[model samples]
Target: MSPAHSVLHAVFGYAQFRGPQEAIIEHVAAGGDALVLMPTGGGKSLCYQVPAIVRQRAGQGVAIVVSPLIALMHDQVGALHEAGVEAAFLNSTLDWQQTLDVERRLARGDITLLYAAPERVVTERFLGLLDDLHARGQLSLFAIDEAHCVSQWGHDFRPEYRQLTVLHQRYAGVPRIALTATADGLTRADIATGLQLQDARQFVSSFDRPNIRYRIEEKKQPLEQLLRFIEREHAGDAGVVYCQSRKRVEELAQGLQDAGVNALPYHAGLPADMRQQHQDRFLREDGVVMVATIAFGMGIDKPDVRFVAHVDMPKNIEGYYQETGRAGRDGLPADAWMVYGLQDVVNQRRMIEGGDAAEEFKAVLRGKLDALLALAEATDCRRVRLLRYFGEESKPCGNCDNCLNPPAVWDGTDAARKLLSTIYRIQQQDAGLTFGLGHLMDVVRGQETDKVRQFGHQQLSTFGLGAPYSEAQLRAVARQLLALGAIGVQRVTTEAGHAFDTLTLTAASRPVLRGEQAVLLREATAQARGKKTRRAGALPVAAADLGPDAQVRFINLKAWRAEVARAHNLPAYVIFHDATLAAIAQQHPQSIAELEGINGMGTKKLEAYGADVLRVVGL
Candidate 1:
């Protein structure tokens, strides 16, 4: 067997490589640079890890891994330690003495792999260490994780990542591999140029995460709908709910807690120690539903997260895909659920236009947002549309909400035109006067409310023009018009400092207003709700398939794992994944030797926990 293959089985405990992993590993190990675009949970770490081990054992020396987050580095190093590999990380979490000890170990050639942040990797002190290592021919490889951060077009761009090109210029002899889970064609080109990897062998894997069921709904009583979704489908399951702001994160977390869910809040506004503690709890404990803003999830390695819900629309499709990809890292069935409304579109657009970015940059951001809006308002499969955003074509995934419960489409051309005309006439009658959705809907539907009569909008020709349509139907039209750029949102502030969104017509409105373009919308009906529920007493591992006795064994193994994790002060998955424990339970391995060939049972883990696992299974 090849060195990479041997390392895969003996150290990482996987018998076979998935997708392009083996090829990427071999190419990089042979001293070739590469840019790898693989999906989440696609064994991305192994593409560089096996090569690092092989080169280190061949006396090439330690590999340097550029990571972004401190929690990620800590978890990766801890997992490597569990696998009996010598790995260390240099971050602020380590005090001066501990940092000194790690540097000494690196100098002594006792470490195989080292991880550090991009900012630290470019520092003069770290470069000095790299210089010494290079002088001795002790630098094996350079692996840049989350390489998309190097590109301004990427969802999570960091200025520090642009400095990483120095690695290529300084260490010309070392092979480099850049990896990211989420990137489109534009972002990919930027990464190649930014990192000076234009000629690197590119390995682009399929971006489909079939295990996740994508669901997007129209926002109506969003808090109540979110609560019902949790209680019905994901009760007692680990998940993440993302909001658009820190205030919403805190409020939603409290609401979930009040409803008896084990939920926690995480955002950048919190104290550093508090955020760290909350993240640690989410990772270490079970049934934790983290309600967070965009700051929370970027390198979380938790494997058993069953769902990722979006309470508000993301700024772009890339951000949405990256966040939703956080669920089902174990390749189990999970859900990517979201609810958006007309206001979501307005808020996202307003933020883009309100930014101080150059017009060209804002235009690109608007384009990205339009793509996300298309995904949200899609009538076909959500997975297909999501994949298309990344320049990938895919068949209809039967797991998505659209595929499971197809919503009927209706012609909203008339409704859209009426909504647009009302906004125009209202502005014409009273220059610079704009109305929000509530007043506009009331005026269009011919409801002579106090605000309607006070503004004298009852005499407008567009009044009662949309009286035939229901409020739900007209709201749907308004959302589609906003998404299509036929209308725009202008933020208005009252004398009392109250802010509200007002509708305005854009150039794109001319075509729809003249009936030259048709507007199609999904019919808002109860039949559109996608129903997914867990079996009453089933475990995460398909209790019906496991049978009663295996279910009991799985539960026992989990209890034992929790105890062991607490003793070690590490996340439970760091010890052994749920899949590994499920395999042990189902196969009923009687001897430690029988557990040897299991997927996650490497030499170190099998030697350490195999006997105890057997005892838990009543062997």
Candidate 2:
């Protein structure tokens, strides 16, 4: 057998490689550079890891892995140790003495894989160590994880990542591999250019995460809706709830806690220790629902997260895809749930226009935001649209909300024209004074509210033109117009110094107002009705489809595994994934020998836990 295949079985316990892993590994192991794009939970680590072991065994020496997060480095090194691999991480988590010990090991060629952050890898002291290793022919390879961070177009860009090109400049002979889970065409090009991997073999896998069910809802009583979703569908399940603001994260976390859900808040504003403690609980314990801002969940490796809910719209599809991809990493059924409204569009736009970025950068951001809006307002398959954003074509998934219960659409051309006309006439009559949605709706529907009367909008020619439409319907139309850039929002401060959003016409407004472009909108009431029929109840467990006796065995095995995990202070999956436990339970292995061929049961893990697994199965 080839060395890579041998290590795959004896060390990692996998019978075969999945997708493009084998090819990537063979190419890299033969001293070839590669850029790999694979989805999360697609066995990305193995592409670099197996080769690292193979080359190390050949006396080439230690592989240096550049990672971004300390938690990820710790978990990876711990898992490697469990697999009987000599791995160590150098990061701030280590004291001076501990750092010295790891450096000494590297010098002695005692470590097979050394993981460090980009900031540390670029330091002069670390370069000196690499120089010595290169002189001794001990630097085997360099694996850059989360490689998208090097591209400015990527969702999570780090300036430090740009400096990583030095790896290619200095170690011209050592093979290098850069990997990321999410990147569009632009981001991919930027990554290639920024890393100087223009000629490296590129491996792009399917971006589809089929296990996740995409569902987007129109926002109305968002917190209540989110609570009901959790209570009804995901009770006692580990999930993530993303918000756009720190205050909202805190509030939602407290609200979920008050409602008897085990929820915690995480954001960059919290004390470092507290953040780490919360992260530890989320990783080590079960049934934790983490409510966080965008600051959380970049390099987290928790594999059993069942749902990812967004209380506010993300600025772009890339961020949304990356955040939602965190769920269902174990390939079980999960949900990507979100609720957005007209204000979400306004808020996201205001952020883009209000930022300190250059005009060119802002334009790129606006284009990205527009793509996300299109996905949000899409009437067809959410999965198809999501994949298309990454330049991949796909048929209807038949699993997203649209395919399961297709939303009804309506010809909103006249309504959109009327809405735009109302804004125009009101602005012209009132000397360009702007109004928020409430007052705009009041004037459009001829409500004769106190504010409408005060503004004398009741006399406007366009007033009452949209009397046939409900407020929700008009809001949907307005949202579409804003998304289309036919309308823009202006932040106007009142005499009391309170700022509020007001609608204004844009260059794109002329076509709609002049009867040149037709507007199509999803029926708001139909969307609300469709939500009632969405799948509800607990997420499917690994052993859900097993026979009754096998199910019991699965439960017992899980109990045993949890105890062992606590003893080791590692995530339960680090010991054995749920799929492995289910397989053992289903097969009902009679002896340690019978457990030999089960996936994920490497030689070291089998030697350590094989008898215990058989005992649990017999129980």
In lDDT terms, which candidate is top? 1
Residue-level lDDT of model 1, residues 339-417, one tens digit each, is 9998899899989877899999999998999999999999999999999888899999998988988889999999998
Q: Write the per-residue lDDT of candidate 2 for residues 378-413, one digit (tens) a residue.
A: 999999999999989999999999898888899989
The collision pairs in model 1 are: none
Model 2 / residue 493 / CA error / Å: 6.1
Off by over 4 Å in 1: 492-500, 527-538, 542-544
Cα RMSD (Å) between model 2 and the true structure?
2.3
Worst 10 residues of 2 by lDDT: 530-539
